[model samples]
Target chain A: MIARLLMSLTAVLIVASVLWRDPAAPVAQPHPRFVKLDKHGNPLSPWQGPWSCVLDTTQQLVWEVKTDSENIHDGYWTYSWYLSGDPRTSDRARGEANLGDCYFETSRCDTQDLINRTRQAALCGLTQWRLPSAQELSSLVQAPARPGHAHIAQDFFPHMKHGDYWSADHSQPLSGHYRRFKQGALAVNFHTGKQYSLPYRNAAFVLLVADLPSEHHSSRTSGVTHQPTTGN
Target chain B: MRKATFVFLHMLTIVLVICSLFTGLRFSLLTQDWLKFLSALLPQGNLYFWHIGSASLLSALAAGYLLLSLWRPYRSSPSHYHLWVNRFGYLIILGLLSSGWLLWLGRFVAIAQPLHFYSLWLLLIYLLMHGWAYFIQHGKYVLSALLPKQPDKHSIAAVISVTAGGLLLYSAAQHSAETLTVASLAPEEFIEIDGLGDESHWQRAPVYTIETHGGINFDDGRSTIQVQALANSQESYFLVRWTDSSMSTNHLPLLKTQAGWKIQQNGFYEFDERTFYEDKLAVMLSHSCEVGADNTAQLGNRPLDGKPPNWHGKGFHASMDGKIRDLWHWKAVRTNDMYLADDNFFGPPAIAQQGQRRYTAGYQPDGKESGAYVMNWQWYKPGLVTPKRLPDQSNAHLSVLPWFGSTPYTAENDDFAPGSTLSSILYRSNRFEGDRADVRARGTWDNGVWTLELVRKHYTGSEHDVPLTNGTCMWFSAFDHAQVGHTRHMRPAILRYPL
Candidate 1:
């Protein structure tokens, strides 16, 4: 009888222990705060969006949306690193041009030519289009759930190249002689979310960005063609 | 000495029951959806180790106790009530042990699972009744008898022998599992990887069928896969067929609405897309036949330390032990037209990257030579999207868009009318050229079934691929238009080759 009582007590304790697990805590999911803008710099409805540029309200930046139309803004186009006037050498040295493959009048697609063309065209009703800083470009990356997938949010920035996009950050010389070390610019690889410094002659893709002024941020959002809703 | 022996046996039984009961419940949650909520609290990595180890020890202890009782009959007698309770307790334990072994061996699981669970409840009840009576009769002083001055030498010997015997049994069971034989093809026989099992050679080959369970969008969440393997001197071919009520080929198609283009998906945000997904089949090969995907499936919110948790909480498949397992994946929409199975492998956990929202642990595709497919849209927003390409013709709905068949997307060139649909998958090339295209495969869907045929080299010598040789264990899983949800089965079908 005593042995049986002990066994019963032990069994109850064992069963209780197995059932005494703590529930997993719920994770918090926040809503995205992005607004889409058209070529005329007008905010488009989230549902009716085929926007030319994306305005990231949180970051106060307007991002260029690439296309696949074989034009200067085509996502598949690549450009060589060239600045009209070098910062270190001033006007003495013009970097390599006409080394990249792109659809342009002269077909001489370089970083300087692209920057000049974008400003002249005043894309998205803004002439401040230029290469984004390394930090700014990386901030646009939303890591994919799976490996080997692209890093940007496809919903907002469609037609983006899966390869590297050049940043405005140039790698400075660490030692005494600036000419001794190879000059390069920083680029962000969207596939792996890693930053790389490429030689000035190496061709890469580009996406222009501009700062959104405080006055134009809220007042220009007039034409919302559809109801606003949050989605993945 | 007698008192010490009794105490030792009782203590051993208690410990074994505690270990096996908890681990068994953990495993039961995998198939028993009703109890799935309890899994959140249970520890979930390599649970089979503890369950099997304790079960083996318990069986050995029971056998030893029975033998000793038969060897020397006890002269003393007990009350009728006490005797009946002891007999009933032993019966319940016996039922539990037998059912447990049947379940582990993957035999008659439909019957064994419930029987084992009921026997556990019975054992608990028996213990309560028996213990209550003992305590009532013996009073408080009866506890002192359990702590003998010292454990007897015989008791120590029994413990060592029991442990050794249990380990031996476990090792033997691991090696001697049933093997599925791969029949040889004659010189004149021919086979094609055209997603058809109508070849005469396939008709002559033996078929191995496995009943799978626990996948969404299936009848009662179950499916059965029938597999046939044939080999020649240099190549091996496999024909796999499974039943699915509907043929789902539309994989996240883009719909052009009055507002904009939106992807047709039900749960893409959570990474668990059940609607607008394609049916898929995956075949994995490994040297070890350990259950639960060779122990690669680590369950729980955070199974691996310092790793990002999976979105579904189902778990992740990663070979943390540095061994590679070959995987062949066939998709209805993605790889069906390519006539190839995306050759992939399970390797060690990948290093966590910065800004990665979803981290696919260990699951990686093999190196591809050239051709591949990419999603049609530039970015994905559940509400609206801008497509990467527009169909040359308006209102054309295709399961996959060929690169040459479509024009680059442009606002001026946008001719798709509202309410038109386009395939989300875009082909970069006709087919793959390198190691990623090693497994030439094709699948066809008929009234309610899918027939898939695959052929690969016997030995490609790639570091990521396992050789199609004798003793290689294989597992098959089927996804019925679901992302990250697949039908699973226990006990791998090990390969055997002709001498």
Candidate 2:
């Protein structure tokens, strides 16, 4: 009987103690697994060197870093959803062209114009820059509780606007019918963490991404990809 | 029968007292940061009605006990010590009940608020003393002695009747009192829209001043706003005045750097820009008079599901229940020159749109006519930005630059010296039209105080506006040069049109 009484008292004290614990206590939070890369795509420390790109170790993808300078990668420039080519390859209707505003020499400021300029410039010593897929782009959104106004990581992506960004995904039909899927493309609003399909002529911001080759794939835990010294 | 009555009454008192204490302390914690630890343990969200309801029940219980004791006085307690303990508990309860009732009735609140707060501590001491005295006398079976066993049917009926009476009284009190009456006054002359409240007829209108707290750049994060409303047959006029140390009119001015022009800001990256923002005031009108923004303010970072967390961990304001609340936003730099308040509303969460920078949840502006103001930048970057327009002449330091007086920006014409600042607000038109220009307002800052005058039609006929009718609940907030950070008050000052 005495043993049972002692157990009951201990159980009550434990419950009370747990209830009284301070909610503000700092529990261990998972650190972001990212590798910063310089202009020529060289790995650098989290606190050192001017970086032009970020490598998400978890997703094993190379993402472009927008800038404030008057260049093709200027963050303020906006582009409409347009690609002048065959409709079958795009999985949707050929979007309207020359409807966006940019710092490029060509009057056409559509998504295809940005892609051509980025490839010719070979930013981050790679020529494979393209608009990211919806799932791939959304992976960059930091956990909801993280600090900063924009949903993405501010340290990796500087000059980040609170506007919607265009994704490569479009409102395509489920079957192989390409003609029926001519409505619009998908865009992600980082301000509210929401996705919506915008019309083909609607202007939005863009962020490019590239795939790492199989030979260049680093360890899964810390996949930091360093480019060769020779320019691409 | 006596034992059963005593047990039932004591048990009822315990439950009502606990409910009142928790709900009351939660409200007191708003300004009393020292009692913050008690917040995690107390009930959250809309505690005002619960506090009032429990007080009504407690009052009914106390009155019932008094009548019963008068009819048949209690036998003398076996112990003299227990008798004195019971008397001390009664004294503490009396203090709590009297102060609480005075606060609920909104009479002598200055003294009653503190009296009611301190009485809870005395109640805690009384509970400890009473429990200890009973435990010493009754030994191990103190619990069994207090528990009522097989109470007669008459006693049960009495308990039910007393509870029903308390609930009925609470429902009646909810409908009456706590309304601020806006008297109808005939102005001797035309009321000018100037920011001066010095009209002779303004003196006849009654003034309601509320002390709002918790915002940056205020006097200890607190400021008292004085509001007076007057209505002719056609239009309703309002005069609001508040104290602000500095006249913050320097909005996000662009500073020319050697690299280029960069928008001047401190925390705009985090959407909590305190410096270089405009001084503003906001007024919200809602049909329901519930506290905490009609329970629309959801606290915590990620309060709403499937929605991004707020930049600041404080909270977000979204009308989840689909009720529309009209908001009038007046900015010193953006709208002061136009002599109009930007009409806005809080409705259901908006569908996210492309190219939109900020997703303001349920807060959105009412539809406007063609002409409006826009930021004077081709694109905004924290590091550098290219201006959309340049000053036509030498006057480049104005807070708002007119579109007709400026030339389009060109590299060759960019002759401004480095470190020079330019205004960012580019006015396309004089003022807003349509439903967005419903309220005509003007404000003047003099000697550390702002006097603002506003006037609108009695019924705007727009779906976005709430008609100036009787019992229209209104709330006022002030921003001292901070964006999205405004001082707030708990209780709304309801509007009453003179019959």
Candidate 3:
């Protein structure tokens, strides 16, 4: 019985060793700063910060809490604005929501209520605002110093951690990570525990807008052209 | 036996992988776009990590296999397995060396015109050899026969297989790591002139223009120009003007003329100038000027100009701006003594004769010659008391006199003979005197041609003589005894005359 057990144990050990030896395992290493691709490769989306969503029209989509000017941990303050259109379909709501938790930071607060309020605010606008698509978010992943960033031209959350951003576009199985400097796109596995999020309703910072005239109907949610809000 | 086969196959595969990785990495470095894409796929950090990981894994596996094979008790000794593995390892190494040499030759030498095909063939051959070896070793019952033992053979095979697999993985990792580092830092572009002519006569043109189909903006400083001539099938001469400003101008010389025309700082200009003889040759000169304040100008002299004139024409007035305007003309005349002859040797009293009956020689008053008899004489004849000596007697001891009088030979009329009457006169004398007089006159009745000979002996013992007919004449100096005496010597002897 002892010999049989020893033999079985040896066999098991051999089998286990073979199985554990993963030839294709990626060695633990720092991620590349710029993810280049061939002509056929797709672009990555912006990062998703610490935020959750709930459909509510009564409250603002993203509210900031006033904190110490130097430190974000001091306290909270509320800044409000009226939504001109439905939060679900308005360009303003889409643009604001696609920024992820860096600007929204809804993960720590009432995520569901915040999402609902965002949708309501977008719907309240004279024109509709909705979440930006993957392509739209990708377009914003330009070099940090490019000229087209008029309103939100500056990175809204300067202190936000740098990594891959989540996009509404789920074309690829792996989530996209947009690089900061080169604006390169990378496909990352969300399950690999490499994701980070931003907080919501933080007002110690400022929120920019693209103020368009009332005559134009800005309800179209095509990922092609969505200007940032001009007003505060 | 099974253990040996596994080890052999694993080693062969590892060698092939390494070679392929090396070649691929080199290609990637030469082309930047490919390198960039590769880097993204396998970042530097990951490449290094994987390299270390794979090497360790493969080494561990190989060691484990060896150990297990050694520990097992087999009917056939482990020596047989060891021998097979050794043979297989040797073959792999040989194959790798051969493939590497072929690749290196293709890259560095012109052993073959189309190296790509040769390299590909070599790679294929290596693969085939590897596959052939694998098949032979893995054939059915080969391992069993070699092992000849039950439990020992199985355990030994297991260990060898594991070890080989680990080593293979390790080799791949190392290759990948090397490739990642080298290719990431590859150059972006290789700049070369596609149609530049031969390097020897390459001319630097002033302006180089590049036209790209796409709207690409090149930094002004980084650009260069290449110019070629279609007519001569040669590179044109030019100078590069690197500057900070945008505008520049220059003046270039025209062909065949000493004077060049004023050309704008940056455009093509043409001009023509007349030669001294009023002959005209077209001068085609071109200048390319870049528009910049810091730009400079260079003048290219045509290849024919040996020592180019210093921007000034002699005997011509030039303006303050270096322009040649007016020219001055000068004339010169020369004179020297010469013996004259006529068609007939017996024309006047000034004639003299001295030679034998068949061929008499003398001097005549006219310059034309008529008969076959010839007479030669030297001018500036030496006096009886003093024999003339040549100043420069290095080669021939013959005295030479300037046919025309002394005058500076100018560039304008250098083509014509100095003593020709058409352009200038050299010498003329009226008095005729000599040692004594001797005459031989002959007249041909049929052709009305008369031939005569006359000789004049001077007081100084020197004599002048000539043979002449009605239309023929000859002249000579009797003092030239070095020659065949005055009888065979004469000056300006006429050789031919018409009836």
Candidate 4:
């Protein structure tokens, strides 16, 4: 009788865990739209994420904004695009993701953990999430960008830093692409929104992007208004 | 009532109770005095209402369980110990609730603090006692309560799956922690304190990388703090660098807005924890020489026997008696621009002077200048110590946005006006002395990196400061944005002065 009770309880717990979606997951779905970019590099009209996924109305990709405020600002959590001995294949990322805690359970959550566990968790309700390609990542900065303000669209992405982010595309195992943000009280070392190559061992921030979503984009309003660029 | 339903509620209650206990422990740990590290992840002063709310529910349930026992009585012939332990556990739970409620309401912290703290353990003890009683009531079959008579692949698969999941989480933390060696060599040339870290002497210095341990909830663990050190015959120069997504020098200030005396956030005022403290760093040097007979260099505060009812000061950290530890705190706001890190030492308990309060430590420049600068904001201010502001003192505007004036803080911008104690210390104090701001630090938050150059005389000839030697071990903690009673560190890196 006791055995039956314990097994029954464990089964109920497992079922309950999967059925509930984490409320922190992004609410927006993904779709493709082709549009023009302002000279500052911002899309002509602001892109909106129903939850936290930014739909590049123009690029048609869904990008996960580092919604975790602590992660968004934490410099140490940054990672290289590739982990050593990683299968280094896109298909492996597409397989069924076994889930685990990325924050509390681990000693460190690197790019691999982000891909496997965070991806498995189906953040923003998509599982095929992976690193942005070189060009895809480069599109974030609009240089001759204002000093101190994010070169990227603040409307969609807030709490952004000028720190470089890792891009999946790599020339050699050692070298990978990174997208830069404007730095300084003034954008002094501003690179006019360009991509640079560096060693894969170098840590860069992770911002996941997914291909077109199964569900059509949401028309639901996010309630946040866009602030126009004040930068020169 | 169904047995399964009864078990489920009890089981869920147990899980929440355990969670509450841990959160309660964390809440208590962060309240102590000896902390030197800052948490960039958990915003300080975030009240854990969930912890209290959960504990309350647990207490209520435990009460209900005990009352139910009274209604039915333990009829089974299980040991009398089980019957008694369960009752005692419920009583302890009630005790926890009462004390926790008192702690949450902020009353009699001295009494409520310890009672609520220890009650969690007492309650757990009851659980252990009750566990044995449970086995007595159920017999040996309870050992494999969830197992089938025959082991099956499903069970093996389940075990393997759980083990693999643990490994996945464990693998993230598998990197070997390297012992970074800090080589101390005399610089070939006099080091300049300019923001630029490009001097030839600096270029030749040994670079050691240290990793931050806690606050992984926000970080990827890939960020490395670069530490480079070089000492000359006259002075020692240490340069530390790290990457931050953004820079913040915004120290929350006491503001007098249209509504009246207001500050941006009340964390600093309410609890010493700060959400808007300037991005800062600290270096703690504990002398290995003459380490107490106990062989410990770091000293703790003297234990209080009687609650000095009139104790008007914030207490000292872990110091038990006598010797103090050396601390060089670099604040991006209050002390940095002044070319001075807060030269603070922690050791002796606060000595009540006829007119002032003093914590006796070695290096302080005598004239009542040691310890933290802020009154550390406890309700114990002796009198009306309002700061006076003078808006007309100067037109220095704060450069950053979110605020309009040339400066983020101004003496005149506060409720007390010229009396607003002292506003932003960007402009040097008019009556400063040599010892007032001793250690010189120059750094700028440019782009994503803060390049800091710190220079101090090799020896200040103070009994308090231990002269730098080959085997000095100093702990470093970086605060992205925080202040006061803040202590946390992963591992202390090794720094060796050249023979």
Descending-DockQ candidate ranking: 1, 2, 4, 3
Q: What is the C-alpha lDDT profile of model 4 across A1-232, one tens digit per residue?
A: 5765575578657756653432121122112232222211223223222234655655667677553222322222555445434465544322111121234334544466676655666655567777777677767665422223345654345445456666666543222222232111111111335555555445556667777453534332223333221100
What shift in Å separates residue B160 of candidate 1 from its native position after superposition? 2.8
Model 2 pairs in collision: none
Which candidate model has the greater TM-score, 2 or 3? 2
- What does candidate 2 score in Cα RMSD to the true structure? 9.8
lDDT tens per residue, model 2, B431-454: 987788999999999988889999
Q: Using lDDT as the measure, what is the rank order of every candidate, best first?
A: 1, 2, 4, 3
Candidate 1 residues A178-228, lDDT tens each? 355477778898877888777667789988888887878776554544442
User: Which model, 2 or 4, shows the larger TM-score?
Assistant: 2
What does candidate 2's lDDT look like per residue over A1-232, in tens digits?
Answer: 4554565578668767765765431111223567767677676544433567777777777888886545678887888887666566755447777778886756758888888887787766778878889898887776422222367776567666677898888654322343344577878887777777777677799888877655556633243333211110
Best by TM-score: 1
Q: Which candidate would rank higher by lDDT, 1 or 2?
A: 1
- Give all TM-scores, in the order shown: 0.71, 0.61, 0.20, 0.39
Model 4: residues >4 Å from true position, as ranges?
A1-232, B1-28, B31-188, B214-224, B289-316, B352-387, B392-394, B399-436, B485-487
Residue B365 in model 2: lDDT: 78
Query: Taking the tens digit of each residue's C-alpha lDDT, what string does model 1 give over B42-61?
Result: 67666666777788888988
